[model samples]
Target: MTHTFRPRIAASIAAVAVLGLLAGCTGGTAEETTEQTVTFWTPQATPERLAAQEDIAAAFTEETGIEVEVVAMAGADQDQALVTGAASGDVPDVILHASTQTGAWTSQGLLDTEAAAAVVDTLGQETFNEHAIEAVTLDDQISAVPSDGWTHVIAYRTDLLEQAGVEVPTSVTELAEVATTIKSELGITGLAFGTQAGTASATEGIQSIFQAAGCDLVVDGEVTIDSAECTEAAELFLTLRNSSVAGDFDVTSARAAYMNGDAAMLLFSTHILDELAGLDEATPATCAECVDSPTFLADNTQFVTVLDEENPAQYGAILSYGIPTGANVEGAQQYIEYVMSNGYVDTLGVATEGRIPLRNGMADNPTEFIDAWGALGIGPAHERTSVDLYGEEFVGGMAEGINAVYLWGMGTDDATLAGLVASQGVLAGQIEQLYNGAAAEDVTSAMKAAVEEVQASL
Candidate 1:
């Protein structure tokens, strides 16, 4: 797919057309007609993803007679583009973005919370995942329509664990013990995860463990990273890091280690689902047994969704559709409703492995979309449904876990502040300190101070 960053030229053209219509109309029985088009900005800019979105847009236009001008925005450049567009009153009518940005954008007056709430009401709020809806809500106003999401998981080699006679870990303490035991027994890396400072992968890796430990970075609009829970979480995360492959591990290296059979367990997102099945040619399975059967690792792998037994939670990334303040409200609402209903499955099918359905289905059939999601084909080479690969039982468990996925400050007054602090990699930097032998108490104190500085800057 081609990546293009274009200005809102279509909005300008529409404005000119509207002016022409107004000038030409006189005091007569004249029927002034114009096409309704919703400008949509999406960060899913890959060629394949863009094509899938275009297909959905085309269907929406055919059914509703409302044109959708889909704009591809690179994920890295979307924030800057949104800021500049909002300043010039040239923003798209609708935007598809990560849930992390919804609160911040709404706080900046770039999003229309009332319009979003209207869409939710029109579509029946009960149809959507309650947690997803809550994630994009601020001050009782829905800032965006939840589209899709995925959770982080511990993908482990079931075969190795079975041989070692060790059950899967369910808490931080058990996880560390399992990792240490696996390494000592098997003479291989026990866990593979990112540790690189200032990287999103590293931040997410630690954040998942941190949150699972019942520690909240921000509570009641105050920085709480210095709590006792945070200190214990930090210490446990360092132990996990110590058990991981010794090196500068990032997302790529960690996945590579697992795919190449160098690690027994991998802390990664659900996006690795297809790769585990040896479907992506670029990163095919390279495990020893994979030479004979590329899917050997997949067949021997199992996913652990929740790690904390006492405080069970799963870290996730949610993508949503947001209507901007100056958007064509009517057209945007129609489009969002259609995408969440008739076109919902196709939208999620863009990348089934990562796009878990947030809106379950119509009120009549709550599991309609959830069931379809499990059956959606995945992988670039030989497509196969997740249900076909992992079975229905596992897929259902994942869907259930997604309903209560956790993020640092989602659904809170300080969500924007928390997002800013997370983006700055404060937690990851503090994690690096832990890796370097800093006391957990000291690291937690530094994390609290850094988060406070970020909050003050806002």
Candidate 2:
């Protein structure tokens, strides 16, 4: 869980990026490198999906004779390695990464925006989901080729909530009440969320709650961590954790808790629906209640995209690929184009449960991929599913949900992102302290100080 890249504490992001450009390449200039081969680093996908990616790359090679080296890197690890590789001037030709990293890395001048834009244009910009394009665009430049997207939601056990006699929560205050009530009535953890210090999950946990409280870590390019709204958000999180959340919550633990029926509610990505429904391979839930219980996919869960509150929004992140400035631009562009075209269906087919296609269509058909994704049949605990578990309404909600994604420092420049990333640990740690019995006032004060520290560092 140790991170190699600490954006919050990065000394000089611009300097690091420039240094990477000047010194990071493995050995020779672009002319000296082999034209037949291009290196690609992919963010970690499921084993099946990873294998599918390799297959797609291989097929691309078969057609074009340009060999692609597919390397899988986990999320945080990729972040660390990319920064390190960039610093050493040894980055891969193309990297598949999260949308959040687009602004940061592009600002560092690590990404070739001109090359990315060309590919997007070649593929036709109108073919993509507008949100996908917006996610990767910064300062009027397309930083990366948008790939897939993930929608965040507050997923809850409908049966359990009903038993606890609580209504579905639509606001931060209402959610807190529901969590407390569920815990007290059911004698189970009411909420599960990642609070692990110094991890991406922790950052996500903090930002999700903070947004619900109507606070942006940065407002109009100014640090607003000390604003009244942010403080209230922190206070609200402290109150919830102290009353109903597990003290040791992290992404893995939180998901496990929900899957095992040990938690009544979980804040998670849309992918959890696949897990809750059970995969086709006959994986069973570890929850004792699941032995003879109804499947969670059987009208036992509720998915919430946006809360009904003053500042309503849900958290989401996009996946994308970009060519580094010093790499094989032609090969990189070709590979990206292939993924968006010839390989599009097969590539997204592997994880249709979670990957909402950013490129919603092809030249001939506007809704081809989107429709295919909607009807993707795979999961099976009892009967197989087609991601239509909750009906077309749920699917439409998710499609709309992608556009509703908002996070702290979103749409801002890289400097603000640096502060946001750096302060993630601070916010996470403070929340954990509250869970461990720290006073709310103290936690809020600490968060304010930590936020200031991150902003100062930037």
Candidate 3:
């Protein structure tokens, strides 16, 4: 079926001269395909990913006689390539993505929900995370399948806490308290953080506090970051900065610090078990293999899995995939279906932890961790205690405010409650400007305005 893009191309025919020159130069005299070959694209299209892709591709090609060509587009070219391919009518058969960008992309008319939905139905909704599927859906249509599910889980060094005569923390507040104690006892920053600023995973951990602070960055449809609830979340970051062993650590730095055996706990990727493989065995070792303690606060039952309805947060990453609608739709469907089947599930398990999903009737067959997680009421980890995130305006606005509060607060006196309260919206605007290319004062004004609107709405 023709989608909206058919018109965008037809409309572009007005540039016949430019199209003629490019078309002639590339393969003007060569015969084009009458028979179909499916093309696949993904950020994970490395040789390792190809192993999984090829296993299923070979099966499908042998079984159905459809050849699937897997592409490993350059990292910088991924988004551009997708855009170019979509624009040029050469889109891949299947694609993988983090569904958070789905909404924006779908809204801009870059996705095909119908093609993706057909695969999802055959695959079964339960095998995938419903929330992530919902995230990709626009106007009640599915956009992508939950390929690799991840949620933020609390990862702690069991031996260290026990050795230091410390108790494991069950809540964010308690976690902070333990950091303080660990700091004093070990004479090291009990928590490690911020090797660099504005990294993805690091930002994810920093934002988890929004859930824990009992105040999130959003309230309803407005930015509530300046509110008592959200401001407190920023305050917690100030606490982290003051107490953490490594100040302003990036993902590599944080992982290195923790792996080095200095940091006691990290609110990090639960899928870290992948790195943990033979990790404890690494040379000149820094940290021990911290036990997998899926402990949580007494009250909270389920853990947060952002963008993944099934398992959401292993501290903060979205594991998602999709099938492009335009070309070789059948081949795309086959590749996706194969991965969901029993044969390839373990490949995902190897990458993430039990964090990757198991095929239907194979859930218990997954790693021991998944089986244990099934029994947990909260099931492995606790969802952070954020007040609100689903709101459109509020969530985006508050994220900026929290980013400012934490980034400035790390390793500085500005990391106090008073400091966060006074400067949140002030510095939050700077990042807003950086992302949007606006004036600093305007960004601050925008945040203040958004906060005021939130107040009025409340």
Candidate 4:
């Protein structure tokens, strides 16, 4: 089987090169010999999580008599690892990954679409979140089974904003001005968005700006990176960067800067509040306010879905399970159906904060799981929800923001998105040059050329 990457991998080839390099690998246990067993791989590769997965597998075996082996791969490595596994004929029966890859993987002839559809049909299509199911569906084919999702938001200190006497920015232009004002008046970093080139964190921040402004790398097979909207987005990045104290920050440093109180705000996923709740145990001295307790979210933070106009098109990463073509299809189907059914809540409980229930449940109780999610403990304190640590209002805002998610390459072809990924650093590099005294027009011209080059690669 060949390994094909989705558009999501377009900007980060160095991070996902395992897919192309291992496409033709041919070393693995014979599928026929292990027909009674099923191999499963997950992105939750942590030691503790792996142990929990094994236990879940053990339970499945007890019910079906199908021996299962669970393997864990880090989130950053899962895409390429699965590609390598598929190429080498070592593909797992079930694979857990971002739902965004379903169309590409299915198109490459890697997934068992029939079995995927079967799982959804058996589980009742209406039970799953429409958006989550929509994410994995392409060309009328259900490529994977939906699992959970995370909402992206601008995490800011409410107290800081109130003290500055400014409202959260609602448009790209407002974002630049408000951020600059905050930096100047408060003497703190205005925003801590990732600017590190070619990394997922950087891509998330950059793409959020573009998507919010209704700009995309490619739209309807046309490269729009050099468009007026995109150029304006680039200018906004330059504006924010100049005032930012958290220079060249990635996800980690960005989060630290916010948690350390060095920056007033940061672009982050839903997991931020989860970490904040554990600040006392993990990094007691990280923030002065959280030194006494988990007080950051409770007292200071406010999560905003929009950093620009256009109704705040937020970005979210949906997690799903794709069954491979050559696996034990029957066992894999059973496992997926079981996981999304009886084990749904329990499976999500493993990473409650990050894994919001994408499937609400059957009609008799549509919000059974959604309401339950709010009561599950997420941090070291083991409270009902991050809301318990933060506040109901904050968490509610997060849920409302869920519908704002805008995918980067949603309707575009795989090759075009891949081209964009291959040229991911062009804009980032241009932004860096602008920071070092280059003219905005020069940066814009260079970025336009880079966009043309990537489009040509398609």
The model with the greatest TM-score is 1
For model 4, residues 1-458, the per-residue Cα lDDT tens digits are: 11111111111101122233211122234453334666676787655445556666666666666666666666556666667777777667788887556766877888989888898998888888776777788777788888887877877787888888889877767777878988988999888888776566666777776667666776666666767777777778778766686568888888788878888887778777667655335643278766676565446777776554345567777888888877767778878887777666667666676778778766799877766666666754444465555655654565556545557665336433633553365556555666677766676677667777766765
**Predicted candidate 2 versus true structure: per-residue lDDT over 1-458, tens digit per residue:** 11111111112111121213222233344444334576777765555556667777777776777667777666666667777776666767788887767777888888889989999999999998776787788888888998777767888888899999999988887888898998889988888886676676777777788777786666665656657777777777765664444575778888888888888888888777667765544435667765676465435777777774345566777788888867777778888999888787666655665677888788789877666566665442213444456666666666666656655555457435543554456676556666667665576677767766776766
Q: Per-residue lDDT for 1-458 in model 3, tens only?
A: 11110110111101111111111111112132223465655555545344544555555555555555655554345556667766776666666665444544455566666767887777666554444454555566776665654445444665567666887665556667877888888766666654233354434554555555554344333444456645554555556655775556666676666655667665554434323322223322333333342221111112122322222222333444565435555556666776566334333422433234423233433333233222221111222212111112322322222112211121222123212332233333323232345443444345446545434542
- Give the C-alpha miss distance for residue 362 in model 4, angstroms: 2.9
Q: Which 10-residue window in model 2 sums to the lowest lDDT? A: 1-10
Rank list by lDDT: 1, 2, 4, 3
* Model 2 error, position 426 (Å): 1.9
**Model 3 segments beyond 4 Å from truth?**
1-35, 74-76, 195-202, 280-284, 287-315, 346-350, 353-355, 358-458
* Worst 10 contiguous positions by lDDT, candidate 4: 5-14
- 3 versus 4: better TM-score goes to: 4
Query: Alpha-carbon error at 114 in model 1, in Å?
Result: 1.0
lDDT of 2 at 109: 86
Comparison by TM-score, 1 against 3, better one: 1
Candidate 1, overall lDDT?
0.79
Q: What TM-scores do the predictions have?
A: 0.91, 0.79, 0.64, 0.83
**What would the C-alpha RMSD of candidate 3 be, to one decimal place?**
13.9
Model 4 quality (TM-score): 0.83
What's the lDDT for residue 327 in model 3?
50
